[model samples]
Target: MPLTARHPARGLLDATQDDLGCGWAWDQVHNVTPRADLSCTYCQHRMHAKRSVAGLRYFAHDPGGPQCSLGLETMEHRLLKLQLATAIRGAGHQADLEVRGPEGRWRADVLATTGSGRRMAWEAQMSSITADDARRRTATLAADCVVVCWVFVEGHRPWMPYVPAIRVRPPADRADPWRVITGLFRWTGLHWEPVQVLLDDFVAWTLNEQVVPRRFSPPRDYWVGGWTAPQYLAQAARRRL
Candidate 1:
């Protein structure tokens, strides 16, 4: 599957000869030794005449080729955890990474203990809450012990709010709806707000929020919960680069 024809829901880039009807032709086109810059002469001539290349090379080559990057398999929530941990550590706080909890497991991306020795659990959320997980974590973690934060990234402005639990809608249709949802809650000031978000949007939200804050204060307790493995890996890779 070429990038242009790929399904929105699936990241697969089909390069099979059978599907492309070019058998070994594709290999020749893609595998040829590197050239400084390949340009279609015919298309260039037509462009000089101000014409379109709609059907000229439709079968000759795929304009949108395969995406060779093997992206990470982590979710935005997990990336947020990493970011929060990074931020907390930068803030000069005594932080721990990935702590266990009774309900399931609490991996504090960044754990911090206040000067007074008070514990604070911070989570970066970019997805909606399922009724069950929300109830369990809320019950297991003390309100005062936990301080849930969310980073919503959208057009122009982005917001980071420290709150309790974040309300996320079902994952459907949207790619990354977290930014939109978080934008909606900017004025509320409450940590937990019901919002619709997609996976990628949430990742962006977390990254923007964590990078800035972590530079100042590393978190005491950190957890992430809304993206897939690939997403998380990409984020981690970007940070490393």
Candidate 2:
């Protein structure tokens, strides 16, 4: 199942042994020696820990468990959802993880309300999702008076007919890289920082304009163009340098 926690108090990404989110340090858990809280996050069914012969440990539901579709969530998918939810809450917004939409037809990974009282649903897509499914979920949330935002994790690129998407990357040992002069960070240190780019600006610079095409062409094409909001911000930063 997507990385789930027995108790998601703080965002699941930062969950300790007591919560048991994902590939955590087993040693830490052993040291605590606390009673296990094995409950399925999706269906609330009784779960048990499965430690493979190869030393891989994970949570699994017992026999005759409820068929929760979200049980197919990967560890990466869970982490991304938790990380985005934490970021949203840290920014002074009220956020809830795994919130069900109106009539329970759909669920949002991170449902947040800004200080201005604007409600938005942030979905972290680490696994494959069909275009039709995406639109249906977005529409469901929209009908409930909530805006939908999609966050594509690393290795999962957004396809055509984009609906507000922000790509987030996992951390690496190498130097941090920016996305085409944009402040949007693939990963810095160990945190995933995603910058907000106006959809219109992104479409103009990334699709509509021939000046900034699919790939960076010629000498420093990205450095010259200020069509996108990120480009404008980068240009302004350069002047200060």
Candidate 3:
């Protein structure tokens, strides 16, 4: 299920918004009767508005439709995309969900674009992926000038230290927000250490170009990031950029 759908006359419609950008009340599409004219943004199939027990709003594919690529994504993956997109917009950047590369070379879970034209793909890789496969996919996006960072919500990932990725603690309840558990690091002159930050703050800083990835030396294969602000970098005097 997704939070966005297409309305023939109103353009793109967002279930998460109280105001559909066109001054239409969110209820115009949500209610006991709900609108029947909505369609999927990806497959152009008919869609229906739905609200989860948790009160989250989204659009679900109508029954018996061709399997849409977006419809195939897991619930966790879709929620994470919602989180990433909201954060990117909160940071004053643009976030496009389920973005496809030219000729379908690659599909990004969430494609974030900065005001300066730089783009980054945030991939929520909750499912298992071989280290080599992850590297290959990351390389594919990079070849298209789109950098990627894999994200894992569970803690048992063996590829954690081998890819450009981060571990986030997913919300346990509606009141909890995602907390960045790792993936962002700071060089302490002698070694690197993880930095604790709220997901929203980290996403914002990253989109603003204040945080950056630091690739490890020849012996290591993974990449992590640190803030570029003077205070954060002052401790890494001995580490070369």
Candidate 4:
């Protein structure tokens, strides 16, 4: 998907670069890398290396540096939001990707406007989450638009509120299922590897029989285990710098 031309411009010190669309320029002073050549007019932080992922470019920064304030995880989350925006637009929707709300305050990860002028918002939760924050943002969605949460499970298919979640598994009839079985065992620290099952079957099992206990709990306890959207947002809210 390609980026929409609806990007809202703001007060930004644009840097001179050949690939303007493939690289990012921030106030150089906010960058933290020792070799950064740019200086930021707004803060003491210095710019780091230029990183490109999935064809989009971004300026990397280290907030843990002496003068830096934002955490590295926070920066990564922002990048993830950008990547998700790109993905959403590639799906053929007139997506604004990321944009400031009418108040010029809140920025949505992905704001898509359909041909019929319907608007929708999507927040990709690859990190931690807070229930309160989620509830608040969820409420702010446009009256005619739907707010959808797409939780990517890293190596697994994404989990959505309306869609059933299922784990990927190898075919049972394979002659050497052990190799694939062992991979799943190592991938997800589970007592037993997942067997191929229909999405409906998995949903039924998750809601009905407690064949497998809830793999994910809530808050802090869940973060230590593995990456989950709810856990990521919860942690993101508590950062100081």
lDDT of 4 by residue, 39-136 (tens): 33223344444434433334443354354222222434544455444444444445554455766434455565655565555454545555545445
Q: What is the lDDT of candidate 2?
A: 0.51
What is the C-alpha local distance difference test score of each model?
0.34, 0.51, 0.76, 0.36
lDDT of 3 by residue, 90-145 (tens): 89887876677988889887889998999999888867787778878888998999
Off by over 4 Å in 1: 1-78, 102-109, 125-129, 150-241
Model 4 spans > 4 angstroms off: 1-49, 52-56, 61-83, 143-146, 154-241
Model 2 CA deviation exceeding 4 Å by range: 2-38, 48-64, 155-160, 173-241
Root-mean-square deviation (CA) per prediction: 18.6, 11.1, 3.3, 14.5
Q: Can you give the TM-score per candidate against the true fold?
A: 0.31, 0.54, 0.82, 0.39
Residue-by-residue lDDT tens digits, candidate 1, 55-125: 11111222443332111112444444444444554454544434445453443323456555645555443
User: What is the Cα-based lDDT of residue 83 in candidate 1?
Assistant: 42
lDDT of each residue in 1-241, candidate 2, tens digit only = 5334454432242231333435555444332546355566568776555544534444556678778766666666765665565556545566666776656777887777876676777676666777666767766787888866566654544341434455555445224321322223222334334444533333223322222212123553222112224444444445546
Give the winner by lDDT: 1 or 2: 2
Candidate order by lDDT, highest to lowest? 3, 2, 4, 1
Measured by TM-score, the strongest candidate is: 3
- Candidate 3 TM-score over all chains jointly: 0.82
Model 4's number of clashes is 22
